[model samples]
Target: MDVIIARHCVAAGEDGLSPLQRDLIEHPARIRIAEAPTGAGKSYAFQRALRDRGHRILFIVPTRRLAQNLANGLSNDLQDAGWSRQKAAQSVAIWSSDQTAVLRSQGVASINGVRLLQMTDLGSFDGGMIVATPEVVSGLLIRRRVEAGQAGEGVFDMLEQFDHIVFDEFHSIEARGFGLAALFARLATVQLDNRVGFGVSRISFLSATPLDLKPTLVDIGIPEEAIALLRERIVPDGRPLHGDVRLSLVDSPSLYDLVLDHLNEVVEELAAGRQVVIVYNRLVDLEKDLPALSRKLPEAGIDPARVLVINSVRDSTAKGRHQGGFAIGRQRDPLAYDLILATASVEMGVTFRNADFMLMEPGFEAMSFLQRYGRAARRGANGRVIVRIEEQRKPWLRAVVDWVRERPGERSTIAALTQVLSRSVQAEFSPHNTASTFGQLSSQAKWCTALYWSVLLEHASNRQPRRGHLLAHQPKGAGAFYRLEQRVRQLADEPGLTEQVNHWLKLFHAQAFDLRTIEPKIRVVSDTGEAYDYPRVWLQRETEVFERGIETGDEIHIQGGLDDYWREDKDRHAKRDWICHFPHTTRTLRLPCDERLVNRWCDELEDIDPYEFDWEDHPQALEAVQKLVRLTGLVPGHDPEISLDAVSGVL
Candidate 1:
């Protein structure tokens, strides 16, 4: 549908645009690249664009969690504000990733209407912000949805009518595939298919750490000056729920013990302050020891109400088949639990409006650490993030961790990934890494591979994004080359080469510090079937407290030791203990549902000896069930007449 053909296409009523929204309208970019921090009121930019006279708008992201959250948020905000013309029953639709043809034939799979889509269904929404993952957008532009006949709408045509496209978590783009994001940025800068192609009227990229995307931005066409002006200074944190984040270096310390100690402190604080608490990124290198991880929390005086654990695996599950938000989503509540432990999932889509404290592992992944840190310090409340690491992991950690950390140099992973994606866009193509690497991949596989490639490729490049650093003495008339040379010379004259690198390193560090890598926002919706008064679960993060913290100016780097007995002691109970509540893949039970809808509910309980599926409830099958139950357990007088014992004699 064309913008001219809309049932109503007039900018009507008073939708007073915010200051930033005004900037979006005034300086609308042919290749506009805009970035604002978490609380900087970024959503206003899109709301302004909603008034555009375009046939459609496309909103892209890196994760399904983000897509769902944005869908719900946009719909809720729109309805509450009365811009929503949707029928009550058709308020909005959450497009799931499980809409297979089989499910569609059953009338449950669909892509139209207000939707939540995987990276492959970007074409469903012809003229609205079709919230999607980068993978889906990439597929829309670079590949076909399915083969011919087994057809669906192609985003190719749909991409044309878009007035402006938005990439919210631009920095945390897919590691395995960010073809859509990079392509969008690259084309947002240059026009290929007239306005229909990549320009999409105007493209805006957003993220907490928008700096990490500087190279990609410049490569696209965002003026270096604008990039600087948009991302000026790091906003000082609001008051933290936790005290000053104390990042400490623990050499060869037990990772479990350190986390346990940290968790204990948060629990204590929650109990005392009666505050909801949160722990960010607790799954890294801690999942194994994390199960027994909580056994000692009670010893530290923490209650379950004071703790809520979340991570990425749950996001994967909720992507399909599951509709709960416990594992992932932005949870902000002042009156819920007392402690909140989380992975990167809390940053995008979810807003932490009341949190004010955070504990983070220390490393050079500055933007990420900051985003997680920002979760606590919203609503003008003070907040802090303490980045810590086991000192023992430093040597190997620096080798492994630092290798993958985003840097400011041209050759860094962020740059390379951007360039490769940019070139793919220029050529209008996407990668085939999945088909080549196809296998039963653990959910972690995509991220690990993308991380490794970023380290390996970007570290070898020479491109660099312009940072807000200048030379001590350089003529105003000097070109970029002369200024850069002068700056390098002055730095060379510093105390050491390290000090010289320090200048650029400072800006580079700031870039990484501001990269917007994030876990997709999640919704922890609890299902109650058809019951109206069931206990409801909204994503409300409990506050947490940690002991001993790092002052703002403390050495913001973490050193660790790795020469310890890192064991992978696998145990049976370990499966569900520390990790996510992943359904048992190896087990399957068949349940019949209404023919129109087939739902699989896994009652993992294999069989209860005391009770049977129908041993007593259905007398016909009672004898056979009783006989089978006897092999497992035996009892006397209380036993049914068709008991396996008596059935043995009958046989």
Candidate 2:
């Protein structure tokens, strides 16, 4: 079943990945789960899992941006130790949406760059290790071929074509729409028979905090032996490491400015030739700020191309290694980029390992806080992280601070993360403590928690979701409708469908339902009209209270911004961040009305008759609120200008 992929990797001749990673790879199990603390050498563990398990390999990551780093790491580090060229071609392959149709149609090479050619244009390749985002791999798993030879059936047939699969960030598996991860979970149980009968699926699930996975793994049917191998149960978190790291509060009145100042210093250092990683909580800030950040670095003597910025927004936009753009001018050493600014992309792979200092943007969740900080000290070097929380955000950041202060071990970040997940981390576990990710104490001896861990181990070791599945997103709660209308009115100009818009108002008089779902409400009180009636705070977009951040459903933390002028300022700056009720297509949005943007938005929407668009087949425009959010990143709140009832019919 295992096919020798191709000769591509160039060994760095380094000692190897960290100890934890080494243990992960050497494990003989065809499938396993491995948990490491925040900094417990999981990335290195991923490599060994890929190497010893034959040549064919696949790595899945939670973020598209992280896939590149995974690709880079696998290329340099995946050596046979003492094997022939033909013996070493099967560790990894990278398949991203960005790969041009032609390149994907023709076989593409692994990072080592040996285009072995495919059996067909698409399926089955020998020995190649693949790096893929969740969706792309989902498309591949259902197919009969890949970078190497043709595939048959059964889990072994699937496993035969590939030596192993690993996923990074195992805790992220979820369901929002038909994500690759969700599909894999569904199939792993039903099709693969809990990954047992078919010896083909050797896997490992890895995570810093594997708490949330207990329920997911339990849902699937797996046994105890498999479960024990899933999570190694390494060190316990919260043991208290005697480190010199300290947390500082930034009481800067101008919080944004303060963040910029700190960011610039890091950038200056990067320009001065020190590699660094910068993590922020929200993608919106990174989106609007990165271009400016990149612009500022060159003046400080940093090469713009050297710096890489990774975020959810960027992941949605990354075009893969097609057309071979950089195939020629490959640099001998890393370039001089002052720093790599990222959202959650810093959470994986070898990319951030070269640096030991970190600066985190404020107002992020506690678990994420730990993950970002973990990016800094790794590979046996002592590192420190500096945090700058806002004056008002102190209360919320306390959980994260306490977790860090607990100190599981001086170097055992994985343990610290475990304690946080077990105690400090603010997460909603459906089946509380009775069920752990390692093994379940449920009535059914099937061991669902271990199964979940098995999935994570496979994912962690593969650095890829099983069969290239993506981490799923949970379904979010929608808000009231009337408020959604008001938000739409404020953000967008009077749309072209005023007639239908008026017709929607008539429904108010004949009110059929007393609120079908939690969609926000919107009433059309004219500019000169009197105050309207709607629910008090019906789905207000989560605010940055202290200007720290503002994501949809993030909880609006207004600092008396609504006392008096708040009424007039309702629509003002609201479009800059927004909340959408739909799942992934329209999950979360940032609002702040921009007349310039609206004008541009209108121009884009004017020609797009939502009536003529097919959301399933095409992603044209999201002018009408009902249009599936496939076109835009996420759906915005209701548009009072355009009625929801009317949008339902037209879209």
Clashes of each: 62, 103
- For 1-651, candidate 1 gives per-residue lDDT tens digits of 000100111111245443444555455554454544455556545644543322345676665556666666666665665554562113333333432333566775443321323222432342345565554443333232233333333332333456656677665553223333433443344433343233245566666555344443443233554332243122223211222222223332444544555665555445446343344444444433444645666566665444545556444343222121222222223234455555666666455434544555543344454455445544444333434555445333343234334332212222222232223222322232211111111222222222222221222121222011111111122133233323433333323334423333222112111112332222222222211110011111111000111212211111121112123342222110001010111122322222211111212222423332322343422332222112112111111112323322311
TM-score against truth, every candidate: 0.47, 0.53
The top-ranked prediction according to lDDT is 2
Give, for candidate 2, the lowest lDDT window spanning 10 residues: 1-10
Q: For residues 1-651, write the lDDT of model 2, one tens digit per residue.
A: 011111111112255444345556655554355655554556655555545444455667665446665665555665435544443444444566445333645764341122223211212332456666655554333321233332222222344455456667766543321223333333333323254333344566677645344344434433334433444333222221112233333444342355466666665555444567666766545544554555565565565556665554233333321111111111212223345666665565434435656666643555565566555544444444556666455433665445445553333334433354345333343335532332222221122222222223222223333333322311111112223334433322334434443443222211211111123433312223222222223213322222332322323323222221222233333433222232112122333333243343333443444454333432222333332122112222343433455534321
* Best-fitting candidate, scored by TM-score: 2
Write down the worst ten-residue block by lDDT for model 1: 1-10
lDDT of 2: 0.41
Model 1 off-target regions past 4 Å? 1-18, 47-56, 82-128, 145-156, 174-178, 185-200, 211-229, 232-285, 293-306, 319-338, 347-350, 392-651
